[model samples]
Target: MDIKDGKIKIAYLSQVPAPYRERMHELIHQDHQFSYDVIYCAKLEPNRKWELEYGNYKMHFLTDVAKTFRHNNTNVWALLKKLNPNVLIITAFKPTMLYGVIWCLLNGRKIIVYNDGTFNSEKSISMIQKQIRKFVYWVASSFMAPSKGTNDLYNSYGVGNDKIFRSCLCVDNSVFDNLPVRDREFTIMFSGQIIERKLPLFFANIAIELSKKIPGFKALIIGDGEQREEMIERLKQNNVDFEFTGFLDQKILPKYYSRAKLFLFTTKHDEWGIVANEACASGTPVITSVDAGAANDLIIHNINGYILPINVNIWVEHILKLLGNDNLYNEFSINALAMVAAYNHQQAAGGLVDAVNYALAEKNKSTQSNTITA
Candidate 1:
């Protein structure tokens, strides 16, 4: 992928590709006018996984600077110099991307900031740290926010509404949207890590409660983590009717989604849970914690799914509520599919395209203003 002299050379500085990013890359490649590069971090820390392929796109993987926390890279400057892109998109506020950000700022290139963080989750930063974030916001020509929660945070930092772009934290809806849905039952499915933050114990508790209320209820958990052995042992000891299918790839996840009558996301706190979106797209209703970022935009309490606390009784009650009433289940399923339609790769890629064009257009106006002043 040689950069043409006159083309719109746009480069994305990212940690790595997950399903959402892979979809974005595929869509961005559809446009022939823009020369794009999806740069990557050479490796992730230890056992963490990104679960995406580099594929056929033009990519540059960088050398690591730190061994832990943020995984900053040292190769950003050299890569940016080589690419000399007209627009640079930073996926998060990392020191690694800061090199390219500062270089672009000094060289008069456009910078677009895409972040999924909101005050709702990471709320303990100091005022000084927030001011620094605002400074970054000041220079960024446009922002790509995944949900209303983040967009609100950017606005609080003095970002104008016009400059904010709504990019959904999406899944490949095409894969799950058309899968044949099963007859309504008490079958529940859970996806995501078995880590503590994800509340793997909460999942087991919910399954136990559901079993007590409904005879022959089944719960399928499809993931693995540090607590996998501990959690599985607990589920088995209690004799809960559950199956741990381990970690299934995105391509294989839909089959389980179709088998499920409902989906459970028991995260204590999450910036954005794309699994919730995946569940909705598969026409399976979702019950998520109100603190989950996806809950605000995706779950319509008792309409599509319930947004409740991490209480076992409450979750069990709602699970039974959705299961007992087939009429309500069908309605929620319809709304679930309809709501997830806008948060697909097609719409998300459109938002990115619009953000880039807006940044360039604004820069052009600024240039014209300076010329007129001269």
Candidate 2:
């Protein structure tokens, strides 16, 4: 390992160069003790026209010899070998990560994983996939999970407790928190893709019900999707008053979050929801299902918002209750802003730094013990 200018060299392999991940890099670079480079497989999402605002960071791109998430394997070894980091981090167990871990194992590099999945998702895993991931865990040095479900996932795979570090996800909260405040409007908001999995159609139904129950209620749907036409058709049929703001960039979200009285995210299942975090930062109460991993972290039931099972009736009851009670909504709104103080990108990035140091220290102790024996 090489220490240049007394800084620990760390390399991170990212599936995508997200704004949040770039923010994480900035937070990591802020520490004088650490120097980092991010290697990305793709600059943009594959097979999608959804272009995200990119960041200028110390980053590298690998030649994606194959082009797909499930099977794409890029030429990552050359740069990794040259960098020769003290610790290497991969974001998932995909082909690129598999390639990364193999190279790390060959070079005896310490490995930390930031999986995009949670253990409690109940997603069907084939036996081969399970065995493959088990081997992946076997070679990994430490894991950084974003949610409790992810921590449980690592445990289910037999990873030791000492080898796990929480905080797999975070957004740089400064942008959302520092946004110019807006007056609360009689509107409910949902920000995400309009996919079947995201259930924007379900959101349309909720919007219809909400508008009918609450006076002057309007729906603010901020996103684009395959189900956009479907959602619009349903909205028209239900005679719901809604505004479909075509997909806005991350930077543009705070204003939408600011004016909305309540933020509703009705997804089938997600490891975590950054929108919920954004809502919390903007001081808007969140109404998300417990299926979202960020629900528990960002929202205390009936405090910042309500978290119930993905049941439409239950969601309507809680939302109507919040809307009907001005005092309760204000209380939740205030609590939302207060609770997000600890869940920022800097804090999440710091957890990664801790993981790197812990792994390296363990390696150093093992080496010393071996030397003494010799």
TM-score of each: 0.91, 0.90
- What value does the lDDT take at residue 111 in candidate 1? 91
Residue lDDT tens for model 2, 1-374:
66778888888987766665666677676667777888878766554444456554578877533267664555777788788887889987778778888888887888888776777574577888888888888877777877777887888888877777766466655666423223666478888888888888778878888768877777888888789899989988988877888888666776677777788878888888878888888888888877898877667897898888876777788888887787887888889888887776656776786678777884522111110000
* Candidate 2 residue spans exceeding 4 A from truth: 47-56, 63-67, 177-182, 363-374
lDDT of candidate 1 over 239-318, digit per residue (tens): 88887889887667876786788889889888889888888887899998878988778777878899998899988888
Candidate 2 backbone clash number: 1
Q: Which pairs of residues collide in candidate 2? A: 146-168
Cα RMSDs, all models: 5.2, 5.2
lDDT comparing candidate 2 with the true structure: 0.75
Off by over 4 Å in 1: 1-5, 43-47, 64-67, 126-128, 177-186, 362-374
lDDT of 2 at 274: 79
